[model samples]
Target chain A: MERIPILRMGDVLLVSIQVDMHDRLAQTLQEELAERVVKDRARGVLIDISVLEIVDSFIGRLLGRIASISRILDAETVIVGMQPAVSITLVELGISLDGVRTALNVERGMELLASSISLRTQE
Target chain B: MGLESNSKLVEVLGEKGRVSLNDWKEAQWAAIKIRREPITEEELYREASDFMSLFQQAVKEAFLSDIRDPVWLKMREMLSALSISRARRGFTPTEMATFVLSFKQPLFEALKQAHGTDSGALLSDVWMTTVLLDKLGLYCVEEYQKTREAIISRQQKDLLELSTPVVQLWPGVLTLPLIGTLDSERTQLVMERLLQKIVDTGSQIAIIDITGVPTVDTLVAQHLMKTIAAAHLMGAECFLSGISPQIAQTVVHLGVKFGDIVTKATLADAFGLALKRIGLVVIKKSGE
Candidate 1:
């Protein structure tokens, strides 16, 4: 029953995966992320996975699914801090992770989320 | 089982080592008759002389069954060095192996003169020499192949790095001019380099100019799409340029949908558009 910690930064929910995630732990994170997106009334979600080096297709799909679910709850997800090798591996794996936003780091992720939220509000 | 044959080999070599060495040099000189530029006859004689002395010492102490033994280590080392040198000098594998195999004829001639009285001992010694020389000759071929493959793979890696270069045409604009076919492996390199460059420069626009890419088949298109998609996820806007009329027709006929990926016929046109996106305009000087 291990849970990945989700921190609340104002209107954004921050999830940082610091360990080598097993399949069950990743599944739990997906479900918990969706629930927290609803409970915290978050406008944006930023996931920091710079620590994740080995990203298989399953984990890639889970990220895409999280983005889809967050959009359903009116929240945007920005996956951040992907290592260079991981990006190459994911592209080779043919998992494009469509509809999931990304940034180089968490700071840029926050900027992107802020701009996206402002754009939505203005629209 | 090979101990008796080993001692007989040592005895034959010890008695006629000098005469055999001279005959071995003559055989080598004749074997390399086709080549004139890289290695001179004098250098060949020197190499053969050194190798003969080493071979005599090895016959005294080395095991014929296993070339990896410590006593045979120097002989193996010498052969590998010779093979690599010849490979670099553009000698074919057949020629390199001939250089090693030629030693067998002279050694066999000298062995017959020494063990002529005893047919059984002579046969055993001749058979042992054949096995030993065969191993050494095959080692030369293996080393030559390994050197050639190592050289080819290194050059290929260099070509891959040189072909895919991402240059910054403007402050916020980058251009990756691809000049060759886009396979999956090169596409992966392009993606990694483009993404890293995007992050480094904080550039928002990337122009992929594939003017030199000769074809736009489905696989190439798929690779391009993957690169573009990865760049998009990195928060950069990617566009395609250098699309000739032929490539355009092929892409259209193939029914490939490049949704919203601004395409241009030339890099100049793409640069103009990129500048416009970044709010920059080019103006000529007054009297140029």
Candidate 2:
């Protein structure tokens, strides 16, 4: 089983999914990300899925689950670089991913996470 | 009928081809004149001559009862071209069918002259002529109908493209002004175009101004929400603008909840909010 590499940028965990994710891979990523966020004391998780061309209902739900798990772990998850077609498909599939924060690209996702973390600290 | 009458019909068409073509052209000219059609005499002559030669060749080679046979391929192609051209030139189906049916009278005259003594052969030849010409006339009408349908479908596609235009208001702001009813098909097109534009321009804000949209029912409201959700999924904020009081009432009555999505009474307010979200402000310059 090939493992997806999760890079850490400062307090943010960057996960760029360049390959198609199957059930096992997504499940592993979810479990590993939860463990990594706790161990590394990461404040945010940025997921880049621009190269992901196809997303079924399973992947959509997995994204929502990942976001919820990160939130519970005291880390914000911002999904970034979602393609237009993927977003349209997700909407058509009626998977709104209600609680997840999204951004246009990695840079915006970082800015979002940084501001959100700063806001929480200010509060 | 027997093959003799078929050959006899061909023989009369071959021998008196000039006179029959002349009569056919005269009849077409009279009809065009009466209808004040803009067809030139030379164009009519050319079309009649081309059709006459193709018809003669096809009748000689193929069975008279069936024009769809491969033997009449050239004839069908010629008629399809003629029918489509006439259809584009604003010719009615009756006028197009008449262009083929007018040949019947002249050919009947020639058949009378050739088989006058034998009423049996003349009657069979006339019947074959009528059947073949009627089939040809109907083929023209069918082709005309197909052309009309092609034109209508093409216009429908063109209208779809023309209606949905994604315009960029500022560097990171885009606006989509919908001008008609929001059916599923139109909504799908608008959503696709708006999403693609958001990706292409990397616009952070999108304003959908429905000022030109006359009404909004539950279905339309659902479509709007879906579009906004899709835009949000792509990381762009969406604003619904230009809601009239009546539409607001209808939306409230329909129990359609916009939830946390922003709604505005006009595009200007939406634009102002969009600018503020992107950290921009429009202020008038001080004049001397």
lDDT of 1 by residue, B1-288 (tens): 255632356666675452467677777787677556478888999888877777888877755566777888898999999889989999998888887778777777777777668878778877777888788889989999999999999999999999999999999899999998888899878888988898788787899999999998988998888788777766677889999999999999999988768899999999999999877988999898
> Lowest summed lDDT over 10 consecutive residues: which window, candidate 1 chain A?
A83-92
State the lDDT of candidate 2 residue by residue for A1-123, as single tens digits.
878899999999999998999989999999999999999999999999989999999999999999999999999999987888899899889999988999988889999999999999798
Off by over 4 Å in 2: B5-7, B16-19
Model 1: CA > 4 A from native = A1-123, B1-12, B15-18, B117-121, B286-288
Question: Which candidate ranks first by DockQ, i.e. highest?
Answer: 2
TM-score of chain B of 2: 0.92
Q: List the residue pairs that clash in candidate 2.
A: none
Write one digit per residue (lDDT tens) for candidate 2, span B19-114.
377778988898898877878999999999988888788776655577777877888898999999999989999999998999888888888887
As a TM-score, model 2 comes out at 0.94
Clashes of each: 0, 0
